[model samples]
Target: MAMNRVQFQSGLSLPAFLARFGTEAQCEDAVARLRWPEGFRCPRCAHDQAMAFRRAGTPYWQCKACSHQASLRAGTLMEQSKLPLRTWLLAMYLLGQSKTNVSALELMRHLGVSYPAAWRLKHKLMQAMLQDELPRMLKQVVQLDDAYLGGERNGGKAGRGSENKRPFVVAVQTDEQGRPLYAAMDTVPGFTRKALAQWLAQRVRPEADVYSDGLGAFRAAEVAHAHTVVEGEGRSRCEAPSLRWVNVVLSNLKRSLDGAYHAFGFFKYAERYLAETAWRFNRRFHLEYLVPSLLRATVHCKPWSEATLRGVPTFRTEASC
Candidate 1:
């Protein structure tokens, strides 16, 4: 049997990760480089020159042009955080390297922080995961499927109507040889035609064709250039060749979510959780670059306060692309 290159590749080992980001100074240098590849620019005045210095032992950059002082963490997701840069970099490493994802409890143990602090840290990083612009629309033959997260509580409804279930769409674009290229997954209001149309508008390019099982609402995928209906349901639908990659991605998603978290507020925080999985998947082929890529995204993400993180629940708006 041939080895799967993506699964078998030599990823960044723990020793290498430690050597690169082991100390506060190393982590700071990495963050600075990722945040400003050319060099430091003033966030306020767009000046390219700046003076680096420490105030009360905290690093800050003063723009040579406007004299505005910006802390090392200012304007980024790490703003207002009191945790050491090493700790933040470690969290990114653990998340980017983990196959099944990390839970707050596990992160709390790893970081030696309280559970609440760990929870905040995890969600903030997940928000950073979503800061990347949405991947360009799938442009090849694509497989689509509907999936759900969460299950009924004891004595609650047991089917799709269950209050616990959150509906999401899964899509995988494949090459001419049927190899998967990219995947997109996100929550929807429901599996209605209007809802699917809104999602397809944002994700499916007009030049692509979408394949799906016999769910009538999937007809909304006609908003693309083409749509093919494969009639099946239940186990048969899951095994159907037309939807193979979508089902495979769905199965992996279920396994990862189940293994990483015993429970979470899936109804409210589904977007960030799903985005975290998709972000990792889209970057799976480049494991060595995972932490640095995540760091780059983190340094670009606008700050999100705990109150804002707790307040906003992302959903697909009705507006079409």
Candidate 2:
């Protein structure tokens, strides 16, 4: 048996990450570069030149023409955050590089922040990850499966009827050799054909071949290129060759959720959690680039407020994947 290259790759170790983005200045520079890779242009006037200054320890860039001012944290997920840039960068690094998900409590210990702050930070980053994943559409050969997170409580209904169970869909695209390529996973309202149809429309390309289990809802895949059903009796779904990658991805996803946070409000936050796992899985091959890539995604993500994350009156209900 040979070693797994992805598992053995020289990822960005903590020491290396610290050396590169250990300080506020370094983190600030990294954010600046990610935001304006070509150079700073005025958000208002689009001027090529800007003046840099520090106000109460916060870096700001002023447009040379319009005199418009932009804080380093402005316009991105970091906006209005009181946390240091180094702390934000560190959170991104931890969440990105971890083989499994990190809990808010662990992040609190790592960042030395209060639990609420850590929770907010974690959700905000996860929201950014979800945003980054929303535009991805799996193509070519794909394996699809319906999965659920959380199990029955002591007094709750059992099996699929469990109120605690949060239904989600998982799809993995494979190459010619059947190696996994990209994964798309998200919480859906249920296994209804309407729900699955909406999910297929978003996460799968029209010309892609979708192979799934005998779930009737998956018949909705006809909305796409094709849907093939694979069935195996008296055998674990994971053991079935046609369903291999989807099952493997689900196994890893469940393990990560079960091992990381002891519990969460599955009905309320399952989408974010599922997206976090899928986001990392989709970017699994490039361990070293995880932080930078995550930073770029975060840079493009609009600011997410606590009210929005909490879902308020609009707390995320499973309308679609």
Candidate 3:
């Protein structure tokens, strides 16, 4: 019999993680390396003359240009967070190592933090992921489908009309061999032409071919490239063999959400979660660099407060992509 190798293997073991990031100093060093790999420069005045030291037990680089100080956690997602850098690094480690999902409850237990802090850290990393840029766009042949999370109502409509379900779009790009390469998922009001346009503009190329079921909203694909419509009623593309990898991706996403979260927080935060799911999916083949990549992204992204994530931002969720 042929052997089946596990796709998701551990890149950084627990022992390795503990050795490198067991202390605040180590975690701060990692962040400093990522944040200012070239050298410390005054973020405000573009001056490189700086002094490195610590205050309140946190490392700070004081710029001589204006005597302004910057910390590793400053101006990043870790800003304003009371949790130690070690805690933040460990949280990110657990999130990257898991192939299925990691609940905030589990994160709190493992990281030894309170539920509120764990929840905030989890969401903050997810938010940072939304700001991270994928290395490539979805191109070549792509499969498109409308998907939803949340359970059906006890006495309401079924399937797509079911109450409490958060509606979203799933698109998977495949290589010439019909294997999945990358994916993009985002929440939408409904599968409208405008929604598709907004999603494709950011994630896909104008020369790509898009395949979807018989939905009018998918007509938007024709605006730039080839669009193929498959009219298969009463069947889900998630299990259909034709789309193949797209089905596998959709199935795994729903399973991960079900396995990890209670209700995926609120529907308002669905886009953030969905974007995060897509990020993990696209990086599935590279399990090793996941944590470092995510941590780097957190450095690149601007700070997001609990207030910013509470309801909605001025940019709007649909356009946030």
User: Could you tell me which 10 consecutive residues in candidate 3 have the lowest summed lDDT?
Assistant: 312-321
Ranking of all candidate structures by their lDDT, best first: 2, 1, 3
User: Which of the two candidates, 2 or 3, achieves a greater lDDT against the reference?
Assistant: 2
- lDDT of predicted model 3: 0.78
In model 1, what lDDT does residue 97 have?
A: 91
Model 3, 1-321: lDDT tens digits are: 655243736578889888888888788788988988988878889799999888888788889989988887888888889998888888888888887778889998998889988888988888777766333468899988887777677897887777567778788898888878888877777778997786677677988988888779989888987888866665464455547677778888888888888775435677677767887877777777788889898888788777776765222233331
Per-model TM-score, in order, reads 0.94, 0.93, 0.90
Candidate 1 lDDT tens digits, 109-134: 99998888888889889988876636
Ordering by TM-score = 1, 2, 3
- Alpha-carbon RMSD, each predicted model: 2.3, 2.4, 2.6
After superposing candidate 1 on the true structure, give the runs of residues whose Cα lies further than 4 Å from its correct spot.
154-158, 316-321
Residue 97, model 3: lDDT of 83
Model 1 local distance difference test score: 0.85
| Shift in Å, residue 64, candidate 3 | 1.5
